[model samples]
Target chain A: MADFEIRDLRASVEGKEILKGVTLAINKGEVHAVMGPNGSGKSTLSHTLMGHPGYTVDGGEVIFKGQNVLTLEPDERARLGMFLALQYPVVVPGISMTNFLRTALNAKRGYDGKDKTKQVSPKEFRSLLKGELEVLHMDDSFLPRYINDGFSGGEKKRAEILQMAILKPEIAILDETDSGLDIDSIKFVADAVNRMRGPELGVLIITHYTRVLQFIKPDFVHVLVDGKFVLSGGPEVADRLEKTGYSEWAEADEPAVLKPEEVA
Target chain B: MATVPKVDVGTDYKEKYGFFVPEDYVFKAKRGLNPDIVNEISWMKKEPEWMTKMRLRSLEIFRKKPMPTWGADLSVIDFENIFYYLKASNKQSTSWEDLPPDIKKTYDRLGVPEAERKFLAGVSAQYESEVVYHSLQKELTAKGVIFTDTDSALRDHPDLFKEYFGTVIPPADNKFSALNTAVWSGGSFIYVPKGVRVEIPLQAYFRINAENMGQFERTLIICDEGSFVHYIEGCTAPIYTTDSLHSAVVEIIVKKDARCRYTTIQNWSTNVFNLVTKRAMAYADATMEWVDGNLGSQITMKYPSVYLMEPGAKGDVLSVAFAGKGQHQDAGGKMIHVAPNTTSTITSKSISKAGGRTSYRVHIKMYPDAKNSKSFVKCDALLLDDESRSDTYPYNDVDAENVTLGHEATVSKVSDEQLFYLMSRGITRSEAETMIVNGFIEPFTKELPLEYAVELNRLIQLEMEGSVG
Candidate 1:
């Protein structure tokens, strides 16, 4: 069985269908890239998979580690080794990043049936946070600031990657993580992800552009259009799409077929 | 990752601190207020004749002044049903063992003595109508610092007490001030000598442990030239079916080049009406700060004020109010700039939940001669539900030309995106809400002492539980 699977998932926002019978599966040690155009329901799928309250799962199931996660709350799904890196992170003023990260880490640990009676000591937490920050190339100053309150665009994205590094979920969903980031930042974030990659982690990189794929190569690339995956291939498919553009798949009514030569 | 204990957020908070001892008073005055009751209180205290006359004059003012019709509902406050004077103990002692057992137990439960021994430079514990226990560290006393109850200050340092008492805030300043002056009994009086700095804070605990009690405590502090002091006070009352009243008048004087900081955390049970008048006067190059937090009370109407009287004087007021079910917190600050080049800042934060209401009432006055002065006021209110309400009423009277004044107010409801962001990171919904609320008041809580800040955060978290379905 796949480590995580979304079977015929249908979701809606504000009574309008966004994810229409989307099926996807991810294994334990593979990176799956979901490339789509604007308004192609990429974020909706990410949000629905994580059980965001605003996104209603009208139909289908999100099975994570053999448990249906659609019925769970966002936080519950997160503890089940599912993580969604938000496209537009919200700013929580007055809460330091260190405090929030620690709380989140502890919550995940407790949910994993660890010894809930013992919290990570301050010294241990600080050292761990320091290591994560170094991996993400974030300054120690970010730890004391209110969570993303006045952070720059690149800083917010880096902070999200930093959180992902600290939490180390089994299946990570990076929703447009490369958006609004400069080339250097994209490289930095991709390097951090590459370092954390191993058999224990599966990555789902959602993006509108193929620019990020130049840094973080994917094992499989799926073309998502109108809430459905129309074509599936490998790294060469992204190179082809980069030249052909999403307009071909975006405007097509039926699912497009991937020519054999485009697959790698 | 300790198993988060199931905090009893639904339980009555007053129950923990509200367990009352049997009524054993050395003197108990009759319910209701009149000139005779005021004079009788003065007579019982054996106060100087002038003080007795002042009490009579204040009683007249209290009667003449009408109930405030603008703020929280005052119709529920039945003046005729309140016991204005009930002295639980006769003399104030320096030792906890010397205090009456019942009163001592009340303080022990409230952790007054423990706090004093831990960090406070001095402590004064007031029960009902009088200070039951008072103590000052010998080091502070030997430094010419006077920290005692107001009643004792009047008898021991009469000349100094008479010089500054009622000078910053007079009897007729407001109706509650007049009422407090007429019936005031136990409160702190601190005098810091010139150039002397009190390193640690002097704390006072006021606990009302009786039904139908009216606690009118008058506090005054004087920080002489180049001196510094910080005074903290905490108040709590027992749960009663009928309403209790807490009307206090606090006055402070910050002399030339001196600084004083006063902090108050009032959690007076849901059956109490807490109306207070607190003001301070800052002289040339002096600084005055008022950190006020109001967490409980059926209705609370308090607006701590500061008067920037001389050049280079500064005033800062950081206040936070949390109004839960059936509570109305009408609290804010006032800053008056009377001299040139003075500066003032007022930051107010409030939260209203469970059909409760919170209002920020601010007033900033810049006099004609107050040129080149600056004043900044910020008020932020958070509503937890649609039924909860928040309001901001600001009155800015600027008569000076070269002054720079700015006022900003915001009323916000918890945003769905913010909640989702926190929850997406594995924090529970209620925990996320509590974190957001704490972050909203971070500026105010950060200004508080470490222990108080932790307690304030805990109280806010307890209040946030079950706030969302």
Candidate 2:
């Protein structure tokens, strides 16, 4: 069975339909890349899957570990091992990153039936955070600073990946994590994600460009257009789209289930 | 749509801390305030003639002065119906076991005795209109440091007490001050001799257990040259349908090169009016800090002030106010720079929820001689729901051209995005809000002692429960 599955997912924002009849599935250890042009509902799908309050799920079935996720709160969905690395992480002034991450990690552990009332000890949390910071090549000073309050764009993205590393979600969705990063920073983030990938973890990278995929290769690449996946193939699909651009798929009137050769 | 989980927010702090045991008092004054009632109080205390005359003069002022038509609504306050004085115990004791069982039980339930044993250098517990219990560490007393109730201080250290009592906040300063002066009873009085530093904090706990009680406790602290002291005071009242009144006047004098920190955490019941007058004078090279947290009371109007009297003097006021259902917290700070090179900073944080209202009314004044002085005032108000309201009223009067004065005020609602972000991190909406609110007031709480800071956060979390959907 799939670790996470979205069947005929339809959603809207403020009465305007965004994710219309979207369907996808990801099992543990698999990496699925959904590439699309701007305003093609790339972020809508990620937000809808994570149950952002702004997006209304008009009709959908988001199943995580054989349970309907749409019926749960965002925090509930998060405890069920679903994580969304927001494209633009929000800044919470005076809330240290260490405090937030520890609270989140403890919440996840609590939901996993490991003594919900017990929190991670300070020494344990410190060592865990230090290890993850080293993995992401982040400075230790970032731990005490307010969560993303004055972080640079690259720093914010890297922090999101660090959170993923700490939480170790079963299904991780990265939404435009590579949008605002230098080449070196992109490689750092990609390397961190690649290191965390294993049979117990499923990855979904949503992006408008294929540059990030070069470092963190995906098992399947899907072309999303007009709120639906028009094509699906192996990693070659991303390479072909990189050469051909998304204009052809975006300009099509109807959803086209094209093969990798057809796109080429 | 996912239904928001319902968590029980009911914690009966009132039942635990508000239960009053019936005890026969030594004396109880009439419900009305007049010259006769004032004289009776002074005569009951057996105060000096000069103190009695001061009480008479303050009574005249209190009677002649009209209620100010600004800030909180005072029409609901019925001064005539308030009991001017109530003495729960005849004499103050220096030991917890010596105190009356009822009074001792009250403070024990409030955790006053535990706090004293754990951290405090001394403690003065006031019940109704007088201090029922008082104690201090022998080492502090041996170092020429005096920590006792104000009433006892007047008798024990009359010379020093007479020189500084009511000096910073005089009776004529305001109507409430005048009223407090006319009927003031029990409060903390501290004197740190020159070059002495009281490393541990001296604490005082005030409780009003009677209905329609008017508690007017006058506190006076004097930090001599090169001395240092930190004093903390906390208050709570039993729940009652009829309103009670707490009008206190606290005055402090920080001498040259001395430092003084005064902290107050007042958590009155909803049927209480808390109007207090607190002021400090910081002399040359001296520092005076006021760390205030106002959490309860139906209506509160307090703005602790400081006056920088000489060069190199500094004043800092950090305050936090949490106004829950049917409460109005009109609290802020005031700073006055009277000499050159003086500095002051005021930070106010307020939260309103469940149709409550909070307002920040702060004033900053720089005199002509206060050249090169700098003052920064920041006020932030957070409203938890649409029904809650907040307001900021800042008055900055800078007469000196060379002074740097900055004021910033922000009124914000807990943003949906911030809440959603925290909720997405596996925290419930209510828990996330509690965290944000705690962080918002971290600047003020961080200044508090560890125990007080932890208690403040717990109180705020209790107030924030069920506040978000």
Candidate 3:
């Protein structure tokens, strides 16, 4: 059964509707790719799922383990095992990446309030980060740098992957993480994500191109056009859409379904 | 709805610093300032004749000088209801009275051990490890460094005390200085001889100097030619004051080729009016740096200044101000370049929250004779909530065409994007803000001495705890 379900989730940015009637159901161990062009609401879906303050929920709900996750704070959603690798990660000038990650790892483990159980010791943190750093091919030098400050486009993408690898979220959304990266960097990011692929994790990779899909290999590929998924199929749909742009499916208002005939 | 918590800064202030011991003490003056009170304060200290006369003259100046209408709102201060001088014999430290449990709890959180917390509270006259302090004092004395209280200096080393007492900042410089001079009682007096360097910061000795706590404390330090010293005073704990007025005068003379750094981190009660006059003069090739951090008081109007008096002299001032609710920190620094080849840098960092307000006001000048001089100033303020406010008033007068001066000011609120990014990583909203605040003041905190930086970080934690509830 699908552990994470998006039931006709609708959202808005600055009073204008963005994600209208978007739906998805993905359980752990399965990797799903959300392919869309610019302004197709891929970012809106990811940000709304992670509870970005800029976006407001117009209707519907996001549910994980019998809880309407949209009503929860972004941090609460995160503590309940949700992650979004932002396209443009914020640049916080003085907070080092290592320090931020340690605080984040501790928070996920319920460290701050009363029950300080499973708190990540500094010793354990260094070793845990060392493994993910090796997977992302980043040196210890990256640890001291302020989060996303002065990082190159590819460096930012890899840093997001590093966070995903460290936090090891249950269901992850990669929002345009592959937009600016070159082929080699995209391949490395895919390799890192593939390594984290286990029965404990599910992923939603949102991008404008299928270059990332070629490396990450999604079990399901959905075409998001005009805020909702206008078409759904297997890997073949991505190839066809790559050849033909999103203009064909951009006018659809309701979500398209993957029929049993297509599945057969 | 998670029940939006009201953002309040320094909410633990009362619980931490507001408890008072019975104000009954021997040799205490009545609440108010007058000519007789000044004379009584001077006679109580047994000061020299010259110092006594100066105190009388300063009292007249304090009466005549009009209260300047500038910076923060000083109208709330009830001068008539303030104790001019109080020489309380050690109640918590010496007598049978025990230390307050809450203050003791704060000391424990600050990691101050059993024998030292009372001394830090300024109620203890002696430290249990007197020999340890004595050995350090012996080294300083051997190096010809005289570290004592101002009253003792006025009585014992009258000649040296008279030489530099008000030379840097005269009583007429400001009304607060005049008031401090009139009733000034206990503050550190240090004299470093030529070419000697007191490697260790003199804070250990300062904590033991129980007389450092007067409503009007006068401090004087002189670093002789080619000498060096770093003198730090005050701690993170809230000082107990029967009166709400705290006007201190700190004067220093950095002689030729000498360098001196004076560090002060004061946490007075929120009810206090902290008006301070601090100034220093650096002679030829000398360097003077004022590292100041103020975390308390209802209204604090202080601008630690430095005058570059000769060629190649430099002045550096780094100030940190945290203004919580019902507080206004109108603080900055002054760099007066008077000679050739002099340079100075003034950096101000302030954080305000919960309807608190902070203003960074700086006055910098380069004289016509100050050719080839340069000064750079930067002011940054962070507002934690929408109700908080911050302002920058910069006065840069560059007279010499050859001199270079630059000023930069930035007022920023903790951005929602920055907070969201951190919170999305599973850290709570309050914790995320705390991280951002600690980051915003990283430049200032990094400059603090190691122990001070540690204590400052812990203080940040306490402030955060108060911020959430």
| DockQ of the candidate models in sequence | 0.75, 0.64, 0.65
Q: Tell me the lDDT of candidate 2.
A: 0.81
lDDT of 1 by residue, B1-469 (tens): 1111222323552365242223252554478987767766776567887788888888889889999989998987778988787654422223534433433343334444454421111113233323442234566788999887788789999899889888888889888899888889878889999999999887764322221133788889999999999998873322222237889889999999999999998876677789999999999999999999998778899999989999999999999998888999999899999999999999999999999999999999999999999999999999999999999999999999899999998999999999988988888998899999999999988988898887677667656863211
- Please give me the DockQ of candidate 3 compared with the native complex: 0.65
Candidate 3 lDDT at B15 equals 60
Q: Point out the higher-scoring one by TM-score: 2 or 3.
A: 3
Query: For candidate 3, lDDT tens digit of each residue in A1-264?
Result: 488999999899999998889889998998898887778898899888999899999999888988999999989999999998999999998789998898899898888745656788788888999988888888999999998999988889999999988898999999988877777888889899999999999899887777678899998999887788888888888887766666576353322222234321
Comparison by DockQ, 1 against 2, better one: 1
Greater DockQ among 1 and 3 belongs to: 1
- Model 2 per-residue lDDT tens digits across residues A4-65: 88999999999999888988989999999999887889999999898888999999798887
- Tell how far residue B339 is off in model 2, in angstroms: 1.7
- For model 3, the local distance difference test gives 0.82
Candidate 2 per-residue lDDT over residues B42-99, each given as its tens digit:
7666677778888888989998899978989999788899877766442222454443
Off by over 4 Å in 2: A111-118, A250-264, B1-25, B90-136, B205-214, B235-243, B466-469
Of the candidates numbered 1 and 2, which has the greater TM-score value?
Answer: 1
Best by DockQ: 1
Higher lDDT: candidate 2 or 3? Answer: 3
Instruction: Summarize candidate 3's per-residue lDDT along B1-469 as a digit string, tens digits.
Output: 0111222224653364343223252554477777777776676566666777888899899899989799888887777887776665622433314444545556666777655666655556455466676787788888889988778787889899989999998989989999888888888899999999889888734445555766688899999999999998887766544357889999999999999999989887677788999999999999999999988788899999999999999999999999888889999899999999999999998999888889888888999999999999999999988999999999988888688888899988889899889988999988888888888878877877897887887777667666311
